[model samples]
Target: MKIIQKHELNSLKRSVDQGTEEQREAVKKIIHDVKQRGDAAVQSYTKQFDRVDLEELRVSEDEMDAAYESIDGEFIEILQEAEQNIRRFHERQRTNSWFEPAADGSILGQKITAIDAAGIYVPGGTAAYPSSVFMNVIPAQVAGVERIVMTTPPGKDGNVPEGVLVAAKLLGVHEVYKVGGAQAIAALAYGTESLQPVDKITGPGNVFVALAKREVFGDVDIDMIAGPSEIAVLADDSAKANEVAADLLSQAEHDARSSSVLVTTSRELAEKVEEQIETQLKDLPRYEIARASIDDYGAIIICEEMDEAIAVINEIAAEHLEIMTKDPFGDMAKVKHAGAIFLGPYSSEPVGDYFAGPNHVLPTSGTARFSSPLSVDDFTKKSSIISYSEQALKSNGGKISQFARLEGLEAHARAIETRKERWK
Candidate 1:
C-alpha cells in the first residue's frame, strides 16, 4: 500500500460510472438478443458464460427441499436469525399511504404502493453469499412486493448452490432461475417466455451485469450501478493496527479492483498497520487478488490532524467507513459521506455485511455522497394524490389557470377553466 500525505490524495481517484466501450457493446448485444429471442437467448448465454447447459430455468419445489436438507442445521438457524434481524430493521422502513385534507374538502396526499414484481440477481461465480440473498430479498419482501424473482449463475453441474437456494426458500422467494450475467438482467427487463418481467432489478454482478443494468434502467427501475467494493478506515493513535489491517483486507479480498484505504493522524500507527497488512496477506486464501488490490488501489494516508483526516474521508466518500478513534461515535458526527459507517473496533465492516440488520448493498465509487443503501423504499413507488372540491376549485382554479397559461400550456389552463365553469 502506498503511504502519502493529504496533498497526494487527489491522484487516487476512481470512477464508478466509466465503463469500457467493449463492455457496453457486449452488454448491448446480449440485451438485444434477449429482447428478440427471449428464453432461447437466455439459455445460450447461460451456457456460454456459466459453462452450464440448463434444461430447466426455474428451481423446482423438490430441488428446494433437497437444498434445505443439504445444508447443516446450525447454518440454517443462523440464516433464520439473520433473517429476523433484517426483517425487523426493514419493517421499520415500510411506508403507508397518507392524506391531508383541508376545510374546503380538498385532499392532497401520497399513495405508496409496492411494485408488482422485483428481480434480484445474485452473483454465483467464485463465491456463494447467502448473506447477499438475505440482504437483497428481505427489503423487497418488507415493502410488500407481490412477487420476487431471483436469478443466479449455475455451476458447471447446472445446480444452484445449496446455500443460495436455501436462503431464497427460507425468505419465501420461489422464482429462482438458473441464469446470470447480462442475460438474466435482459430477461428480467424484457421478460423471457418462462420468466415474467419485473418492475425493478437489484443485486450486484460483474461489469457486464452492471452495464446491462445501466442499459435497461429506463425500461425498468434499478437500484443503482454498483462498482467495486471499497472500505476506508479512519483511525487515530488509540486504534489497533492489526484490527484495522484485517478490516481493510476484508474488502481488498473482494476483487483486484476493490479499494482499501487507511487515513490516520499518527504516522506510527499507519506504518504498523502497513506491516500488519503484509503479514496478514500471506495467509489469505485470496492472496493474489488482495495483494493486487492493495498494490494498485490501497493507500495509507497520513493526515496532520483529525479534521484533516475527516476531510479526506468526505472527499473519498467510500462505500464503507470505519472509525477506530477513541470516541468513534463522537468522530462520526464530522463524517458527511459514507454508505455505511462502522464504529469502534468491534463494529467491523463484516458485521453490517452479514448479520447486523443493515443492508449490505451500499453505494460504491464515491456515490455515497448522493446515493443511499438499498432499502424498502427501492422496491416501492409513490404517487401524488390530488382532488379539488367544488368550493376549492372556485377559490383556486383561476390562479391555477393563470399559472398554466404562464407556462403556455393552453390545454392545462383550459382543464382548470372547465372545472371553474362547473362551479359557476
Candidate 2:
C-alpha cells in the first residue's frame, strides 16, 4: 500500500472518484439491447453471460418451497435474526403525511405516499448474497410499497440460488425473475410482456447494472449508482492492527477495484497492519481479489496529528468509515462526510452490512458526499400542501397582482386583478 503525508494529499474533490469509461460504454450497450429486444434479448444476455438457458424466466412457488426446505435450519434462524434487526432499524424510518389547520380556515401540510411498485435487483451468477435481499426488500416493505418485484440471474443449471430464494420469500418479495445485468434493469424500467414495470428499482449489481440504472433513471426512480465497496479506517495507536486488517479485508474481498485505506498518525500501527494483512491474505479464500484491491486502491497515510487524520477521512468520504481511535465519537463529530460511520473496534462494517440496523447498500467511489444509503424515504415521496381561503386571497390580491405584473405575466396579473375587483 502507498503511504502519504496528510498535507501532501490532494483536495477532497480528487479523493472520491468513479470507474472507467470503457466499462460504462459496455454497460450502455447492454441497456440498449435490452430496451430494444425485451425478454428475448434478456434471454440472449443470460445465455451469453450467465450460461443459463431457461424455458421460463420466473421463479415458481414450488421452487421457493424447495429453496426454503433445502437451506439448513441454523442458517434460516440466522436469516430471521438478521431480518428482525433490519426490520427494526427501517421501521423507525417510516413516516406519515400530516395537515395543519389555520385559524383563518386555511389548511396546509405535506402528504407522504409510498410508491405503487418497487423492483429489487439481486446479483446472481458468481455468488449468492442473502443479506442483500434482506437489506433491499425490508425497507420497501416498511415503506408500504404495494408490490415488490425482484430480478436475479439464474445459475447455469437454470435455477435461482436456494439461499436467495429463501431470503426473498422471507421478506415477501412478490415476484422473482431469472434476469440479470442491464436487461433486468431495462425490464424493470420498461416492463416486458411478462414483468410489470415498477415505480422504483433498488439494490446493487455489477458495472452493467449500475450504468443501466443511471440510463433508466428518468423513466423510473432508482437507488444510487453504487460503485465498488470501500472502507476507510481512522485508527490510532490504540487500535489493534490485526483487527483493523481483518475489517479492511472484509470490504476488499468484494471486488478487485474496491478500496481499503487506513488513515492513522501511528507509523508503528500502519507497519503492523501491513504485516498482518500479508499474513492473513494467505489464509483467505478470496485472497487474490482482496490482494489486488489493497495493492491497487489501498493507502496508509501518516497524518501530523488526529485532526489531520480526520481531514483525510473527510477527503475520501469512504462508504464505510471505522473510527478506531481512543475517541471515536469525538472524531465522528468532526466527520462531515461518509456514507456510514462505524465507531470503535466493536462496530465493524459487516455489522451494518448484515446484522446491524443501518443499510449496507451505501454510496461508493466518493459519492457519499452527495448520495445517501437506501431507506424508506427512497420509496416514498412528499408533496407540499397549500390552501388559501377567500378572505386570505382577498387580503393578498393587490400584492399578488403587482408581483405578477412586475414579472411581465399579464394573464397572471389579470387573474389576480379580476379576483380583487370581485371582492371590491
- For model 1, give the RMSD to the true fold: 1.1
RMSD of each: 1.1, 2.1
**Steric collisions counted per model:** 0, 0
**Candidate 1, after superposition: displacement of residue 61 in Å?**
1.5
lDDT of 1 at 26: 90
TM-score of each: 0.98, 0.94
Evaluate all candidate structures by whole-model CA lDDT and list the values in order: 0.93, 0.86
The CA lDDT at 309 in model 1 is: 92
lDDT of 2 by residue, 1-424 (tens): 6676666444212232234798777777777776777788888888888887877888899999999999999999999999999999999998889999887778899999889999999997568989889988999989989899999988878998999999998887749999998889989988877898998999998867877888799999998877778899999999999999999899889888888889998999999999988888888899889989888877789886998888889888899999999999998999988999999989988888889889888887778888888899999999989897887777777789889989999999898677766666
What tens digits encode model 1's per-residue C-alpha lDDT throughout 312-352?
99999999999999888889999999999999989999999
Residue 179 lDDT (model 2): 93
